[model samples]
Target: MIPPPSARPFLDQAGWAGAEILPLAGDASFRRYFRVVEGDRRAILMDAPPPHEDPRPFISVGEWLCESGFAAPAILARDLTQGLVLLEDFGDARVREHLDAAPAEEMAIYTRAVDLLVDLHEQPAQSGLAPYDRAVYQREAALLTEWFAPAAGLAVDASGYTTAWDKVLPIAEQDVAPVVTVLRDYHAENIMLLPDHARSHGLGLLDFQDALAGHPAYDLVSLLQDARRDVSPAVEQAMLAHYQTRAKASPDFEAAYAVLGAQRNAKIIGIFTRLWKRDGKPRYLDFLPRMWGLLERDLAHPALAPVADWFAENVPASARGQLDAGQSAQ
Candidate 1:
């Protein structure tokens, strides 16, 4: 349900005569996107549905990312009143498409992606233009309680989750690592495989409106433990090694990694939950077990020792089973 003030431009603009616009399939979020072609040129038309969709943050973050050398979609033009944007087309080949065609070549792609992550993490904390503070993280986590927990049909552990949050915040605050403006949704689906450029040498980035200043491990987890797609353990470990080697630390880096992974997964659980109940997108619910498995793997580490105890006391044992049942019923 969108008004046409935003899209009327293509028909009106001098540069875009004969422009044909096609509605593109959208993700779980409220935003709607279209592919526009005028002559040989191609671009995207964005519509952030009103009241439910706010363009301010998305616009601000998009500008910041475009300036920062990350491969986010560029804003060619905007109609703020109608919440629309004309964006550069990054081509349609998502990394998932590439990986699917040649699944065995994931190693080379992993290496390249790991290199991209290292470059992002190496940016200094002062370089970050956004911050992922407690309010942001907590809001994201609440999505789980509100969305997934109900779907799980387990008693929402309001107090227990609060207690777990209390247990982990100190460890997170002690994160001495410098922050970078993280593409909070950085992952394979958002990355494109472009050719003919020295950089990427040809990778494109998309769907990064929620950029934040956060730990180095956040984006890495986002890539390696994606909910929409699965990354093999071998590839995950190889990428981790690439990261460890790139960062060359003074103290134990593994400890930092474990805590960050747990935190990232915890945040994602809530997001997926929210995607289901609030957004009416249930595909993400299937990824809950993968995220849970990540949590369990992370908890095996000694750095998550206290958090493990907290998790054991809370979060149900039949967690995966319940989610599966929910999925089938849905």
Candidate 2:
């Protein structure tokens, strides 16, 4: 693929003048990635357009992860003004791809991923990170009403949803212990299982620019309750139990997980809907059913009664997954 005119200057400045730039799959963001190859040497070029996307967070978080004994990509060259970074290549073997290619390795691979979290939570969180506080949670969950409600032909107002969430916030925020560096999108696709590397240091991470200081359970929930793929029930249960046992987490950890899971799934439903309606990317819609299912499970937890009650009152059973253009004006 021909590099975009805007990207070529940065690529050339990074000494990839004669390299072949191949398009790599991008995430649900404004940023784009390209694989650069110069003979046997390789690197990844991150094109994060400024004024909308920033590369500073990724650089800072990458440094923190590397310092913390994890495998985040090394930044070879950067031009923050242009929002471009040439990064050390981690190859093309993502954990999800590896598992799909070799089904038998699923359990062991996931265990290692969980173990990485175990190690991360033990260290002190990086300084100056934002908290995944109540406002943040409520703001994110608002996407469900703002975008999904209209797309699904519902006329639900955001006031009731916000009020209900306000009630649930106190209970959900309790027993959260302390927040860590929550890699907001820790999942199979973003983690690499480096061959021949030690289990603890083997996993390579990507897409962590949005890391926040949040409950330890949030990242764990993102990993196991993935939006892109189905995590088997057996594996999810085993991993959850393992994390609780290993982390020596509080007795209320399970409740926190359920509440956060519900909140996250609710946010994603809005995000996916927005991605399709606003951003013109409809592939995210296919995952709505799975998201709804996960949200249902989380809502069932007694700790999420307030939020669940809000959903039951505002969103009718028939309107759960249906999308149209009837969203409330506010």
Candidate 3:
């Protein structure tokens, strides 16, 4: 694949002018990725065009992770004006695809991931990062009412949704746990299994530009309750126990997990719907049922009573079921 014209000068400056550029991937946002290869040398070219995307947060967080001894990709070179960055390549062994091929190794692999989080939570969070405060939580939860509800042909109680979130969000922000860096998109798809590294230090983190100072439970919920792939409930439970024991988390951790799970799932449902309706990406609709299933499970937790009641009253079981892609986005 051809690199964007603007990337040429950046590549020339980074001394990778003649590298072969191959299309890598495009995510939920407007940013695109490309793999750059020059003989034995390799790097990832991130095309985070301005106006819609920024790479500075990604650069800062990644550098912090590297300094802290975590496996976030290293920033090799950057040209912020042209929105091009050369990043250390973590290879193709993403945890989601790896698990799909080697189901038997799922437990061991996930154990390492959980252990990484335990280690991460031990460190004090980076300063100047935004807190995952109540306003953010409420705004996120309202995505269900804003995009998904309308797409699903349900006229939701938007104000009631906000009220329900107001009642429960504080539980997630309680002082029972120390605030740590929450990698807001931590999930199987975004974690790489580095074969060259030792098992304990092998997990490579990606797509963490939106990291925030938040409760430790938030990232765990994101990992175990993934939207793109099915993480068995048995594995999820075992990992939760493992993390709790490993981190010596408070008794309130589970409650925070449920609250954040519901909030994140709600945001994802709205985002996926928006991707379909506004961004012309229908493939995301395929994950709506899985998202609803997880959201419903989270709502079953006693900690989510207020939000659960809101869902029960405003969004029926019928609206939350499997959606036909062609019909749903209409």
Estimate TM-scores for all models. Answer: 0.87, 0.94, 0.97
Cα RMSDs, all models? 2.9, 2.5, 1.5
| Deviating ranges (above 4 Å) for candidate 2 | 199-201, 322-330
Q: What ordering of candidates by lDDT runs from best to worst?
A: 3, 2, 1
lDDT of each: 0.71, 0.86, 0.88
Evaluated at residue 236, the lDDT of candidate 1 is 87
User: Candidate 1, residues 243-321: lDDT per residue as tens digits?
Assistant: 7788663254566667767777877787777666666676776788788888788888887776677667656677742
The best candidate in terms of TM-score: 3
Instruction: Please give the distance, in angstroms, between residue 150's alpha carbon in candidate 1 and its true position after superposition.
Output: 3.0
User: What stretches of model 3 exceed 4 Å from their correct place?
Assistant: 327-330
Candidate 2 local lDDT, residue 258: 86
lDDT of 3 by residue, 174-242 (tens): 758988999899999999998666633689999999999999988999999998989999999999999
